[model samples]
Target: MGEFAQILRAWRDRVRPEDVGLAPGLNRRAPGLRREELALITGVSVDYIVRLEQGRAVNPSPQLLTSLTRALRLNDAERDHLFRVAGAAAPSSGLVPRQVTPSAQRMVDRFRNAPVAVAVHTAIYELVLWNPLWAVLFGDPSSQSRLERNVAWQHFAGSLPVTHTPEDDEAYSRDLVGHIRAASGRYPADPDIPRLIDRLVEASPDFARRWKAGTVGELRTSRKTLHTEQVGDVVVDCDTFSGGPGDQTIVVMTAAPGSEDEQKLDLLRVVGLQRLGS
Candidate 1:
């Protein structure tokens, strides 16, 4: 095998199934993540993964590289190496970093059974990583494409089940646009940033107007009501914290202590993903 394929298989063999949320079932043939499991997590076909590992697939796109980087939990250096081997340029310091450190992944894993829902977003608002509670709270984001995973895109152009008052809607829109604008300035080298802006400008008149007005604001703690089929309507306090490189934002959703919303969240946690799927 070529150097790229050899290292890819080595990395795949080193990562345990449980590390990526898969159950460590009894009597497995391979020691680490199987080809199918990697395909499932990275949203690439199993055939493609096999081809990649065999050095048959060449010139993987940057998006595919990003997916694999996240799926294999590659650190910054490893991520850059993956890019170099794949004949792609690694994101520079000026670009938004999408690499999720092992520590951050552990942090998210810690909240797997917690009542609080957590999700990690890139500088440009792309939803990169999230916990099971996050999936239970806000439908599973794994099925969404890279562009569809963006928070700003969902609010402006996609049908996200968020209910807000007129005032709250106005403020939230401004905050999202402001953050996107700031990210654009910070990560000008990231092509996705400008493409996202252009798509939003074309698809969302509200976003276009705000962008034209140059409304720059900070993300603030806000209350939002989410309508879920299992839990009905639940209100949550949405809080964001700066995390890792690339201006990644760690968002936590919690309900007021002892409130009905809290009770609902607890119920959702107990119900879990299997029940939600059923």
Candidate 2:
């Protein structure tokens, strides 16, 4: 294998399955994530991963490199090395910082077994890291496409699983647009931000109107009723914190203590990622 392939494999072998919200099942041979698991997280095909690891795929795209770096939980230096080895320029400092720092990752890891749902998002709302309980509560984000992984795009162009009052919905729409606007200002050198805005403006007239209206606000604490087939409706208190490196935000969702919602959340933790058969 080439140096790039060897290094990639070694890094992949270092990341445990549990660290990325996968169940560390008993009877496992290797402790690290499987190639298939990495493929799933990076939104790439298993065959592609195989080709890359076999040295058949040379000079992988920066997008793929970034995804791999995140999936393998590479540190900043490792990320730069991955880029350089792959014949791609390292991500510029001016770009919106997407790498979830080790400290931020540890913060997410600490809540792996907690009943509260937690997730980390980039400045532009790209879903980065999340816990198993978050998967149980909000569905598996890894299953979504890159664009689909974006919270802003999902909120404006697509439907959220959560139900909101009309007033709350309006306020939330404005708030989301405001956050996007703020992100655009903060990461002016980022190409993704402009592309995202253009897509949103084209796809949703509401977003276009909001963008034209110049909504500019950050995400704040809010309440929403999340509906899932497994748990029905769960009223969760959503709060965003500046936890990760750069403009990343850690989102935490919790139910009222001693309430039925809280009990349901606990039940979700027990249920885990097991899908019930019809």
Best by TM-score: 1
lDDT of 1 by residue, 165-224 (tens): 788888888988999888887777878888999999999999999999998766777888
Predicted structure 1: lDDT: 0.85
Q: What lDDT would each prediction earn against the true structure?
A: 0.85, 0.85
Q: How many residue pairs in model 1 have overlapping backbones?
A: 0
Runs in model 1 deviating more than 4 A are: 27-31, 34-36, 44-61, 165-170, 202-205, 269-272, 275-278
Poorest 10 consecutive residues by lDDT, candidate 2: 269-278
Candidate 2 vs. true structure, TM-score: 0.78
| lDDT of candidate model 2 versus the reference | 0.85
lDDT of 2 by residue, 94-138 (tens): 988878877677778878666789888988888888878887766
Candidate 2 collision pairs = none
Lowest-sum lDDT 10-residue window in model 1: 240-249
